[model samples]
Target: MAEGICCEFLKGLQKIKIAEELISLGKIACDIIIISLISQFKSIISMLFLGHLGDIELAGGSLSAGVANITGYSIVKGLAMGMEPICSQAYGAQELTVFRKIYKKTLRLVLVACFLISLLWLNIEPVFLLLGQNQAIISVAKVYITYSIPELIAQAYLNPLRIFMRTQNITKPLTISVTCAMIFHFPISYILAVYFNLGVRGVALASACNTVITILGSLTHLYLSRTAVRPWDRQAIDMRLEDWKPLLSLMVPSVFSVCLEWWWYEIMILLCGQLSDPQASVSAMGILMQTTALLYVFPFSLNQGLSTLVGQALGAEQPARAQRTAIMGIGVATVCGLLCFAFTIVVKNVWGKLYTGELEVLALTSAALPIVGICELGNSPQTASCGILTGSARPRIGACINFVSFYLVGLPVAVFMAFRLDMGFLGFWYGLAAAQASCACMMICIVVWTDWNHQAERARGLTQTTEEQASLLS
Candidate 1:
């Protein structure tokens, strides 16, 4: 009877522990989702301001922004993600020195990359001219890109800082900083665009100003917070070329993984222009893409939170905890996927109305929403598994899986169905659904098969001091 009672108590304790994990994950995910929404809102505000300027300004700004995302922002963001494992693991291991070195290294790498990308931004006019773009559009794009250089530089600092804080579970400061910056964005944008009449140039400047404000706010918070890592700590200043190899190894694959997926969406947009009813199809596609992006915030938030939790667990030498976290994250992501599926189906008919009044666009969007829903079912888990892989320091696997699923499998299916099968716009979405499903399946399999104990050992190596690693190697 005593033994039976003890077993019951242990089970109850385990249940409480599971509940605690869920609460922690939910809190972190909520903060991340809020941050993402605010960032999206800022972009919307910038676009709205651009639209007020003129049709030319709006079109040019949109075009420039897309190009910048594909070439500049995506790469920087991907590179910055390399810091996740290092920072999170080091923080968990209580190795503050390694964490600081990785942060500085990542920041420097991003800045160098931005400098190179800015050169490309500067020469966009010539490139667009070469591609036979309209002279007027090229002129506007030139101005928009030129003035957006400051924003690029700001991202270089902001991305690293975000990762640095997030790994340590210091999310409130980030949320507060971004919120304060967003509040200032509207007035700053108005004064620069309307009051000064700088037009698109002013709008770009305002965006940069707000981003700088966010960076400053984050730094100030870090400085003041006793629990947070000191951004200005002098002891964490050591750097060496040899120390950079591990970061680069992770960063390059991460770039490919991110860019491949991002570029695929852009490619789909290009494909829409080739459809028979290009105008309606492109418009509908745009609306559906926006819907997908908005819904994606939930899964992506889980992705971020899971990566941090798993990394911390492994770094602290708790393989079982890491495995459990991965499982819980996948389960949560599955629920999110189901919710997204229901949402798309329920809103299918009226969703397009929010974006357009055209009957043709509305009809196309309604038909496509179901397939997009199916894609989300796959995307949520696939994304969560990506976090698992990232936390385990195996981003190359994700990159390879993405390439095969999207380009090799999905692309051919899309072309055959759309052009040859005469399915048109719907065919494109069906192809995406196929890719997402396959990707998710493969990712989940890999995650389930992961050697958590091995990953814990790897984390130890990653967070080790140079001498410690060298001794181990020898």
Candidate 2:
């Protein structure tokens, strides 16, 4: 009788342990997901304002935004991600100074990157013209891109700060900051764009103002919270140009991997601009992009959390734990993908109405929803797998896979379908789906066969080198 009781107690304890792990993961994941949603909402609000202006403005804004994402934001964001492996592992390894140094270095690098991207934005007009976009869209796009400059600079800083907080498991502050920023966005946008009559440029200024608020909020929270993360050491802010070499080594592949996938989507948008009815096609593509970006917050948050989790586990020298984190992340992402697929399908007919009311835009957007929704099913898992790779310090593999899947295979099929077969926007989306499917399959295989123990060793080596270099410089 006593033995039976002891066995039952052990079983209960095991269940509790499992439950605790899941809860911990869920809590962090959910907070980051909320933050991501709020960030996406900022874009949606801007689009809503633009959509209301006119179809031409909507198309122009969408194209310029797409171009900006590919040329500027994506590169900055990807380079900042180089900090993920560094900071997460440093936190796990209890190397606080190392984390601070890397953070400072990353900040400097991204600032320089912002300056370079600004140059690109300055000369964006000719690029649009050469690409054969409508002259009216080109003109409006130039103004929109011009006003969006501040927002671009703000993001260059915001992304690195967000990653810094995430590595320390300090997410609630980020969530709160972003929420406050988003809440402030709507009224500010209405006042500037409508009441003040600044038009599209007003909308852009409002967005920049909101981002500044978000930055201030996040900085204030971080400075005030004594228990959340470690304090900054003033000494670590030295101009450590040497540190960037190793970081950039990881960053180059990381940038390419992220840019390839992002640029592919932008290519789709550009292709839509080339369709017979440019206005309707571009408007539909814009709506679909906004919708997917909203739904994408889930998997993307999963990616961020999983990267931190796996990086920490590996840094702590627990290969098995890292492997398990990867598996659990995949499970969560798959479920999110399935749920998104179902919801998008149910809302397909009415989804367009949320963005626009034009008969042509509504019809085209509704038709594209199914394809976009189905793409989400594959995209979620693929995105999770990419997160795993980021954590494992193997971004080069991801870069190679993305290039091959998206460019070598998917691009050709998309072009053939959209242009040759006359499938138009539907065919463009189908090509995206195919790319997602292929990337997911390859990434899944890579994750399954990954040697987590080896990755841990690699992480240790990377951190050890950073520590050594820091000591030498000091």
Candidate number with greatest TM-score: 1
Give the alpha carbon lDDT tens digit for every residue of 212-296 in model 1: 9989999998887888887555655456756667888789999999999999998888898898999998899889988998999
Q: Best candidate per lDDT, number?
A: 1
The true-versus-predicted C-alpha distance at residue 464 of model 2, in Å, is: 2.0
Model 1 Cα displacement at 467 (Å)? 7.9
Off by over 4 Å in 2: 1-17, 51-60, 133-139, 194-198, 236-242, 273-280, 353-367, 419-422, 467-474
Clashing pairs in 1: none
What C-alpha lDDT does candidate 1 achieve relative to the native structure? 0.89
Distance from true location, Cα of 10 in model 1, Å: 2.6
- The C-alpha TM-scores of every prediction are 0.97, 0.89
lDDT of 2 by residue, 29-145 (tens): 899888887777888899999998889888888778878888888998889888788788878887777777778888888899999889989889888987788899998899999
- Write down the worst ten-residue block by lDDT for model 1: 465-474
Question: What TM-score does candidate 2 get on C-alpha atoms?
Answer: 0.89
TM-score of 1: 0.97
